[model samples]
Target: MVHNYVMRLNNLQRKIREEELDAYLVTAQDSIYYLTGATYDTAERPFFVVIYPDSPPDLVVPELERARMKKAQGIRVVQSYFDYPAAPGGNWYDKINALVGGISKLGVEPSIPAEISSKLWARDIVTYSLVSELRLIKTDDEIESIRQVARYADKGMALLVKNMYNGVSAVELLALSRQLQKEIVKAGDYDPLDNEFITVGRPAPQSAQPCSVPDYGDRLRRGPLSLVCTLRLAGYAAECARTVFLGPPSGSDAELFHHMETAREIAFSMIKPGTPCAEIDQATRDYFESQGLSEYILHRTGHGFGVGSHEAPWLSAGSKDVLEKNMVISIEPALYLRDTGGFRHSDTVLVTEDGYEPLTTYPATLAALTLKDRRPLKSLKGGFVRRAAGA
Candidate 1:
């Protein structure tokens, strides 16, 4: 892990030099974790890590978190403040400027606090991120971590299916599945960094918007339920989602489900190195339209996934990124019918030298997802089991 952080920091420093940046400043916690192997809940506190071409990387954290942040690798200097609104010597901005000495220009990330940004010495400050594109290509160690968490996500989905039943509310289902997934995460020595959204109802009308945890009151009777789960371990993330039916699916539901699955297959076939990222998205959408489901497409086919839930090399209709080996992306081909629910299963994939490799191993077949309520069993005096009243 220490070696990985050092190598990534070096790569980012090289990019800073290429962009002619005097120094690069970062505030995003995930980006910091990517470069320093430190994970924490920043929670309104101002935390910063700055990198330079010649000087060692420096970190400024809250005094309360100083001991924990100190354990991270690749950071040459650590400065701490007692809290926010500290005096002159206690401010992170002041310490950062002192470390830079006389650098003329500074590159800052998107989430830099206004309090600190206004006080920087650089007159020609630019916006740049050291971890965005660099995170697209996963190292061997990163791939392993992603795969491990991906497996945990798969288990959570299977548990959801086993527990799904008629008249189950969205909140009830999500709570149960979360409990199950949490056990697996702890057993694997991992932690939950974000919420898992499970929507069990008719397709949402707003398809272009972000997916959120469904309202607890909406009951899922006998139709389709969409489940999306993301798991993270050691600062790496893996996500998988699927739409399952409570009972046997209707003919229309079956058709659209298979169509979306077919679109995912098409996207997978076009994931070889050198293929245009937009081309794969266009191909998937083309296939969906060919099957007469064009109106249901809410957004792009998928987005990149790694330390963060979404990242670069987006598979959309207008993307300019070219597919490169080792780039990790999600292949999600989904559509939302006005009356019916959404249909989709986002799979994390890795572009390879020749083709792509699937990191998510969950089964998305109709049979696998068509869940029925479990029947109770009764035992007789001879210890023989028989179907209960409901069965």
Candidate 2:
């Protein structure tokens, strides 16, 4: 998808003029990518995009990336330093100070490194998140890119479902994730460097720990299995997660899953333009509280995701951000029980003018997720089972 980098730069420049700043210096990699569509590995070197109120933005990079930056869209000038820790007058900080020397006031992102921000010699330096604010309302190109990413995430989930079997190991699932990633690259015109594809499988007991890395030795047992697919294509990201059962869920497990699904639907029903993010989260919390399972709730109802996996307009009790049209977010309200498994399903949702649209299309129903006829296979040689061999 071709992005309108010129329009994006114009938006940031307009913000710079509105704030009465001579120039706005962007240091965050993701923000730079959003504005310039330049993808590069920002190692220890300082990379920047300085936008002036009336002129085109200037990109600063290490000399190694000078040629690449020259070809990047929406940048009018490319300045480079020889390397990090260079001579007195040839360093990145030196170039930055020289670029803004004529300007009276400068704007910087809030996430700029303290060391870099402190070295700026501008008479007045103000911290702001202008680019991030612009990103809150995605453009047509961005929405399309995110939609494409959602498609890939859904495909990854579908692959997971097809490969899931009783006694499947985390190692095998991870290998499947790699295979799916390769398939996506071959199937689309995506830059391998500009995307990320990961699938995490956590079979129960470990599924209760959402952030814990699954044990390679852990195998799918007769309990809940949580699968998450996080995909990013051409700089936009989407996530899809579902909790399935290895076999028929026990009566208590099925009841808990029902509550989790109901809570997710409640949150989904509240998604629309102008809705308070907190209200959606509050409603989910209220439902869980009424069900006498509030303590099992682990995190917020959802959070916005775009260039970054987690971005603005968070859906939590304390967030003040309200949903706006075109803002993409994840609706993942999860419950974690000790000794039991996690119960959750996540979908990438787009806020429309009237309501919302779900981008990820994986089925979330228990009947659909349950592998009723699959049973644990007998222990194979070396305690390992290849997917094809298992079949």
Model 2 misplacement above 4 A: 373-391
Candidate 2 clash figure, as a count: 0
Q: Against the hidden reference, what TM-scores do the models get?
A: 0.86, 0.94
lDDT for each residue of candidate 1 in 22-63, tens digit (9 for 90 to 100): 889888887887888777778767778888886689898998
Per-residue accuracy of model 2 over 1-391 as CA lDDT, tens digit each: 8999889999999999999999999999999888888888887988999999998889999999999877678888899988998989889999999999667899999999999988899999999889989989988888898998898899889877776777777766666667667776787776766788788889887888888787666787678889988988788899999999877899999999999999999999999999999999999999999999999988999998889989997999999999999999999988999799899899999999999999998999999998653434433421454444343
| Clashing residue pairs for model 1 | 203-341
Residue-pair clashes, model 1 = 1
Worst 10 contiguous positions by lDDT, candidate 2: 373-382
How much is the lDDT of residue 20 in candidate 2? 93
Model 1: CA > 4 A from native: 1-3, 87-89, 110-116, 177-210, 375-391
Question: How much lDDT does candidate 2 score?
Answer: 0.87
